[model samples]
Target: MIKLPTISTYYGGKGSSGTYQKIINHVRPHDTLIIPFLGNCALTRRIQWPAQVIANDLDPYIIDQWRNAELGPRLDLYNLPALDFLATVLKRPNLGRVVIYCDPPYPLGSRKSQQLRYHFEMTDRDHEELLTAIRFLRVDCLVSTYPNERYAQQLSHWNRTEFQSQTRHGAATEWLFYNYPIPEVLHDTRFAGNNYREREYIKRKAARWVAKWALLPPHEQQHIMEQLIIVTPNVIVNQINN
Candidate 1:
């Protein structure tokens, strides 16, 4: 897994994690990464060209957006059920070094709560089916999820990392499991969101945002920087200095 450049830039709707940048960075420009379940597609938009991304989801709305996006050769849009589409990609001849980076629907913890939360829903069986396929396929993959017993047992050999990212209530824990060993640069992410490292976090985050500003598309770049209490690079500097 080759590490691409790091950036503070992030996107996607609710429940989205910024750690995908680590997964995306590892994808080599020459290889193909299949996005089986493209949600709001923070990863799809962030990917710079020369590296090809096949972005697909069951949602027609998502497909339409992708089709209209003038991303040039960097992205290909499709609307297909994830499992069938994944099967199709794998069967293709001459497909070299393919990586599947996906975020699927979370398991139905509460039918009542989940029904209101997400349009699409998943079950334990669905999770099992996907895991079964992945286990036999012999491919490199990264999947994100909450901790589950089935996953721990099935993917025991795979590398795992615990991540902390912001969510509505406060902080949330998410797990990233990869089929191959991830390098330290990709795995050892320390986000100082606490009061203890407040000054240091801002300084580091400022630098990260700076690195990504030029590379990211203007709209995405804007969204990422907008919610920040500290806005521009110059302002970030001012806050640190003050």
Candidate 2:
């Protein structure tokens, strides 16, 4: 199979189906498919393999959207948490070679009150739980996550490989997780590269600073920085003294 690009035009992109189809071609005909987090079901709908798929998510609205869709795999969008979904998958007797594609929320420290955010941050403990869930499956599995040191360490236990691609906005690094061994030849396939110009633009935009006081020791730094924006004299002069 060919190497698929990782980047998407949007978070839930339309080209995901093509990527899913490539993945399906690698697996056997009667394997069971389990997708834990169904954002838009674009990928699930595109997979044409004749396998039993159990697509689910904790988001009720997303599940509702999947339920109302005219096409896609037969999904059971559960309202339960991720652990609950894993338990349900474990209890299934027809646990053949299972393929799981998960895109859990990348919870950095910046996301404070997002509705879809998870409580426990992405740490080694959470990574262990994720890996344990992946191991629980009786069949082959594939997982995806944003590139981070913690996630990289977690994925090291699996047949890990990296894919880089560019979206319209910028570049992205995606790691693919597989339980069983894959050949070396499949690993060398060339995928698309990220647009460096766009990436640089975003980097520059995100490089603004609050103040050195904000960067002081955590205990010494004031808590108001979260609610207030500290401006330099140049900024103040530009606005008032001009």
Candidate 3:
């Protein structure tokens, strides 16, 4: 049997699909969305971004994968440093109502260093550059990071969000900072259940029930299988009629 690489097999960062939709709610296809620091390009593959979506990163390999990801004509992936490319894109005129999402390398000083790993590791200066750049930007932006005393102290004026996420490492809490108020649509997570996580949950739930049934004693298992033969056909017929 051949083992397939799951979503986690992609190194470094992968954004939650639900989070991606919240980011999507703010815009339509006519707007320009810039993802300055594309880690796993999760933001790219997960949603059909309405407007033009431009994404860039420091790594060429990631750029290759991003371009080849079959997202469609609206997405333009590039290999470039995050700050410089972002600055260039922001400067472009007539682009109008730009939405820049900065999901960058976690700084060494941040508490997130324990759970997060990145090949393009960010230093203290890099963190400062990123935060300062976003603060002054005229464009609307969403920045993802984790909680830290220094960040709270430095960015006290900006709005912060504690997003719920889980990992095998444990139930993890990540953060998001925005220069402007996040839209009410993003805050409402009720519809977010339509993603892969819910489907995976249902699949695992069914598997557990089947596994428990297998563990029954031989006679019981035989009796149950016999019963299933009679019950399964009727159930299938009812489902087909429905």
Quote each prediction's TM-score: 0.64, 0.57, 0.66
RMSD of each: 12.7, 21.9, 13.0
Candidates' C-alpha lDDT: 0.61, 0.52, 0.63
Q: How far off is model 1, as Cα RMSD?
A: 12.7
lDDT of 2 by residue, 186-209 (tens): 211122113445545645554544
> What is the TM-score ranking, best to worst?
3, 1, 2
Q: Tell me the deviation in Å of residue 92 in model 1.
A: 2.3
Q: Model 1: which ten-residue window has the lowest total lDDT?
A: 184-193
Single out the weakest 10-residue window by summed lDDT for candidate 2.
184-193
Residue 136 accuracy (lDDT) in model 3: 66
- Residue-level lDDT of model 1, residues 49-138, one tens digit each, is 335667677877666656665656656777877888898777766556567776787555612234434445567888888888786557
* Alpha-carbon shift of residue 125 in model 1 (angstroms): 1.6
How much lDDT does candidate 1 score? 0.61
Tell me the TM-score of model 2. Answer: 0.57
In model 1, where do residues sit more than 4 Å from their true spots?
Answer: 1-18, 22-30, 110-113, 184-242
User: Local error of candidate 1 at 196, Å?
Assistant: 14
Clashes of each: 0, 0, 2
